[model samples]
Target: MAGRGEMPMRPARPGPPMQYRGPPPMARARVEPIDREKTCPLLLRVFTKVGGHHQNEEFAVRGKEPKDEVQIYTWKDATLRELTDLVKEVALAARKRNARLSFAFVYPDKHGRFVVKEVGSTFSYGHGRGDDAKSLAELGFQIGDYLSVAIY
Candidate 1:
């Protein structure tokens, strides 16, 4: 104890040295590869329009969907580029040299109302703007969801 105006000093405590652990386990986890041979393909309902995408109001009512429909049996691992090639097979407008294809997912919301959400886009005959590598699973595609393609 100090008798005057001097301050008291405390003893120092020792602790273990800090170590740098890399990224967390979840961050380093890898996605398992899916086997297409044994897995059955899902039926994907697609609608196409030459100019622009179909409005959400068009799909508001049941049995009133757009007239042009294409059914595709594909896996969830399918990329946008693969889907674009498949669309070109049936959609003549999408086969143009400089045509553009915009993709959107149509699904029912919490209130059972249909909603249209644009996912990605790709070019017809040339290199895409990076969206070509995005897979259906990466775009939050569901089994019952419908795909709408706008050809421009």
Candidate 2:
């Protein structure tokens, strides 16, 4: 019974309006560290179709190449059965890449010479231990350890 220029519809602005207050739902997703040599675009055409050389071969030049490098030592000299045969060649190349391996342990700095080691900034695939995989040190293989593997 209250018509005549009715302006009576303003009783609905109490509990949850004005865009629900503010700030309470942003727990994860702010990562920004991508600079793989300016974002690996085919990484120089897959290193020129794999003919770039230097695959181990004892650091190439005459080692027979193709392996890139693989000579880490430690873990208590790996119970010396010839360095425990490099854990059956790093577990048979991690079971042929079905995935399963992530190692990080190569120490040598402060001018003792020997270096190389850096991985894990978030690159997905599988197998990752401690920090990831990167290896060197042993400037000439005295056994400070190693693990320069890239077997995918």
Top candidate when judged by TM-score against the true structure: 1
Give lDDT per model, in order.
Answer: 0.90, 0.32
Report the lDDT tens digits of candidate 1 across residue range 39-149: 899999999999999998889988888899999999988989999999999999999988999999999999998899999999997775649988898888888999999
Candidate 2: pairs in clash: 55-67, 55-68, 56-68, 56-69, 57-65, 72-146, 102-129
Worst 10 residues of 2 by lDDT: 42-51
TM-score of each: 0.77, 0.22
Per-residue alpha-carbon lDDT of candidate 2 for residues 96-145, written as tens digits (9 for 90 to 100): 43432322323345765434342222112333432333222211223323
lDDT of 2 at 45: 8
Cα RMSD (angstroms) for every candidate in the order listed: 9.1, 18.5
Candidate 2 Cα outliers beyond 4 Å, as residue runs: 1-31, 35-92, 96-99, 105-108, 115-152
> Candidate 1 — which pairs collide?
none
RMSD of 2: 18.5
Top lDDT prediction, candidate number: 1
